[model samples]
Target: MSPCTFDGALPRALEQIRGAFAGIDFAEVRFIRDMNGRVHLVLPDSADQAEVVAARPHLADALGAYSPGSETGLVRLSDTFFGAALMDEPFLVQDINGTLIRLIERRVVGQDWALAPGTEAGASVAHPPRVSFFSLKGGVGRSTALFLWGRELAAQGKRVLLLDLDLEAPGLGAQLLPDDARPEFGVVDWLAEDLVGSPMAEAMLVERMLVARSPLADSGYLYVAPATGKRTAQHPAGFIAKLARAYLDNDRGGGEDFAVRVRRLLGTLERDLEPDLVLIDSRAGLHETAAAAILHLDADVLLFATDQPTVWEGYRYLLAQLAQMAHIHPAGDDDWRLRLKMVYARASEKQGALEGFRSRAYELWLDGLYDEQPAGGAEDAFSFAETDDAAPHYPLQILNDPRFEQFNPLEHLSTVGAAAIASSFGPFMAALDERVLGNEDLKAVDHAD
Candidate 1:
């Protein structure tokens, strides 16, 4: 069968098989689809093999394949067959209705993000810096900050590519793209098409998906890879279904994990667009989807956090996990801490509140990221105090501005003006430009407390 036929056949076949074997007592029924679109049904040895064999004719018919023969067709459950299929690690598996059943631990490929003893930095300076704006808890103006930052960079004549990886709650597209400028496809569309091995060319993928926003049209370009595609002839509501499938480990057998694919996608954008900087709007909290942006992608991570106890508690858990991962698999350099910067959003101007928030942040970093001191007196290569200027734990504070309380990018930009936005977020942006972007001479207002 053709790829299209295979695409529609697998789920239908599984549903039919489930109905056909409704009376059979089986531990679990798994439907596996190989790279070449061939299908296989796996069940525990407890299942009645004779009954399964009897249902072969119906399965073949449902799958639109020739009767079980040497061609690309269903294979009977056997020890040898199972072993061979296991080696290939079929691209995807589903039950009666295309619900992916994850069978393997998702492995992250590429640069590691662990900050521990002996861990070294692996990021290359040649590529443009990819900065991820992340928050443990939502509603902290993470994406809003990203939009303003991108605008500032573009205003400085830097080409920017803004990627929205918040798949479940995508908003960057609507915020950035005007109705007429919205692209037919999006990042998710390209990802889904790539996962399914579509015949679309890479160049076509960039052309169809990357939407250029108006705000950065004058000085520099702002290209966006939104989460969902625009309504078009090619991309319809069915594309949403592809979004659900894109996050699965369906292509593990081919040695391409989801993280690796995400990296490749970003790389492709970099190659095609040649943007000076890439800003990624990552998913909030700790999730497999967030892992690609946080850990695998070689990005300077901007970890946004509030003064809430629960927020810091979440950071503690996340940092502890990273510290442990670092111990197991260290990076090439110890610059993991350097690549990370803390952003305190919705911050208070009161000295005590600011100091209290910074103190709590310092404690979390010390507990989860800083290297352990030697028992004897040994000169440490790097040491940080909460008040140290060069420390990574220093918080870039964005004081609470009622103007940004209800953020709508276009409305805020038009009403507030870039000058006021810059004034409001001055210190944070200045620190970012100096510390993170290596622009030491940029004159910024003293909005820092």
Candidate 2:
């Protein structure tokens, strides 16, 4: 059916389509800026108006953005952003299936969500929800954080999959796959062979992942998808124009037919892996690879920061650049801000700074609230900048213990679990571990007798 949202003015609604698909990829985007402006965007290899409209609600829901009706993709907003007259429409197409297939997800209304800043009154608290630890800055300890947190969850018996999306820099492989252990194939190899759809598959792929013995080893399962680290050495002349080249290309880096290949990989993981939680330690930083992961990957984001001011500053700076890539927000019932679990490392030595920060943060927030509402109850408090005015801005669980200082909490947090991790990262990680992994349904993946 023609998008249910359209009123039969296909030519009229084209200009506004560009803004809606700002993050989507297209081959040729030519705009006719005339009386009847048309936004003609040629898809990479696959997509069509049907796919875009069908997936609009799903995309909106997944991104936690402004939700639209089923035919949302058909509606567009004027570039002017002038309140009302800015709505336009455009058509979408698919030359190939993007890594993320747009689908309609049904949500019930029995529960409602509200997103309000400062009030902190609305929103749901989702713990143990999947988070892909990512960094715009590589070597920022994304994998390490993923492993530690996974171990924390595994210890609680919550099934977890440490899905490795770092196709190029495969850290988990080095961490899990031992030098002596040999396997005939890896995820990249299997993917290249398109072995996933087969019914009679041999040896489970997750089982094949290199496992590092940890007190938190999850019986739940942690699979590592090893990237080939394979860079196509050469691009054939006019590969894009060659229809035959489509299936053969896997690298999406301006050359390979990445969308199809990636979708296959994601599909395999989603179905075959069958994990309760998937923690993707994404490829370091903001590349096309990372963009795809961020926009399409189904998980909240856990951004890491070291206690070092430089680390925090660098990350904060890069966050602005990343903002343009996707709808970034922390997970929460009503507010997305909560979904962003900020991990401040080396909190032990930074106690003074942390205290100062919280104190200032509280005061600042109070002031802002007061500004927004002159009669606001927090007027006397001075907002987040002053601790006195803040609503107990969650304490900076200092990871003060020297064991954690060295970045090795396993020894300190072993069987003792919670108490051990708290020694370094403050009570933060341990508390998070408890909050996410200690649900009634979870019984300790690693601690299971």
Candidate 3:
């Protein structure tokens, strides 16, 4: 730790510290600012050989808009190893969520970083893909498809934020993100972290929590907001009720404008991490949080359905319910119904069962008896309709694979020789993202009405 030549315009007081540590040939500069807007220095990386590494001046400029840190600052983290944060003098600080930021004394030159050096601009938060892999009835593998979708998206250099809002039967957390790897923090902890918690700014939040590492890809991070907090408390009957509140109530750290909070969180994610998509795997049925959140939040909704009569009946019911709600709200220019995307899962091949289902439904619709007939008119709709059944009327595709045998949430991801359905539904997401907006940018089309 020897004094080195100073050149950058750091304040006069910091110049003395710079002079003392001039021997840091391997210096790495980082910045930390808290919710109250205080700036602090992160000191040098003791491991690297210091040279006058250049600072991120533009990023620095954006960061400097906040006031300098002070001993009596609004709020920030205290790192035992890094000592007390230096107010505006460029010390480290943490946020309420426990994210750590290391503000450099000044931007230095000639050092390598974890991410691309100049690419740090606009590299802020992550917006998890809001994906819904749902089915009208059981056996369609909606959750399983979601697992694959998340894995596939992550494989393409994308950060996937997956949520299991299927409260009554919460299982995805146990499936993909192992008990060994689940984050210490979860949706339930948001309240606890808000109250009796003091988390490390950088490590505890921005880096850890209910979040898990993607074993499918190299260090791909997966953050899941589980339906239940996985509390070991012995409550038997109150599960569903508590789960319902865990999702919709403001007490669980949800704001009055639940939609806006989700938007801001997504915006923060997109800015901070730049994730490709945020996928949500919701529960079945129309009255739960799974339906409410997606019906209100989805940029795209892919409703999965099997080739069974009962399933189709449920599918129709879901659509009707959604349509009913839409009528109540009335579609504005920002209407969400337009973002709906449907996918018929577990479709049987050979066109046998499917054909029978379609022909029967079509005749039922044409006869004006669809309303009167029980939704589940046939045993396996595909049977009576197919063998030579007509084409499907709406959005439907055959996922006729045996991998969907039972309740296996993870299937066919690594199957060497299986007849998996080939689908281009992945690209379907981009179009939907373009449609459902984080913010609407309405430019007038020049013309007369």
**TM-score of each model, paired residue for residue:** 0.68, 0.49, 0.49
Worst ten in a row by lDDT for model 2: 107-116
Candidate 3, residue 258: how far the Cα is off, in Å:
6.8
Selected candidate, larger lDDT, 2 vs 3: 3
Task: Evaluate candidate 2 by giving its C-alpha RMSD to the native, one decimal.
Answer: 14.6
Off by over 4 Å in 1: 1-126, 201-203, 206-208, 216-218, 232-236, 250-253, 328-334, 376-383, 440-449
| Ranking of all candidate structures by their lDDT, best first | 1, 3, 2
- Give every collision pair in model 1: 91-250, 119-333, 120-331, 120-332, 120-333, 120-334, 121-333
Q: Which candidate number maximizes lDDT?
A: 1
Q: Assess the local accuracy of residue 41 in candidate 3 as a C-alpha lDDT between 0 and 100.
A: 44
Model 2 misplaced regions, further than 4 Å: 1-128, 136-140, 180-220, 228-264, 322-336, 356-422, 434-440, 444-449
- Give the poorly placed runs of model 3, Cα more than 4 Å off: 1-129, 188-207, 218-223, 228-244, 251-273, 325-335, 352-393, 396-398, 407-449
The alpha-carbon lDDT assigned to residue 254 of candidate 1 equals 50
Could you tell me the lDDT of residue 373 within candidate 3?
33
> CA RMSD for every model?
13.3, 14.6, 24.3
lDDT by residue (tens digit), candidate 1, 104-132: 11234322222221222233335677899
Candidate 3, residues 1-449: lDDT per residue as tens digits?
A: 22211212133223333443464331243444343434444444352222222222322342343424232211222332444434323232212123223333232211111111112222223334465656555456677666665665455445667766565566666666555556554443442233332453223346545455545443454455554333423343655454444444244243322233334434543455445566766667654444434554434667665556676576565544343233222233334443454455655556465555455445433332122334768532222222221222233454555644564433434562222423423333333334333443322222221
Which tens-of-lDDT digit does each residue in 1-449 have in candidate 2?
A: 23322222222223233344555543233222222221222232233555556545543333222223234323332322232322122211211222222111121210001111221221122323556676656554466667766765555556666656665555565565443432334444444444223421233344443222333364545444544212211322422232222224443343323333544455555555445566777666654455334433334556555445555455444433332222224333423333344454444464386665554333433322222334645533222324432132333333434443334333433544655654554355555555444544656333221
User: How many residue pairs in model 1 have overlapping backbones?
Assistant: 7
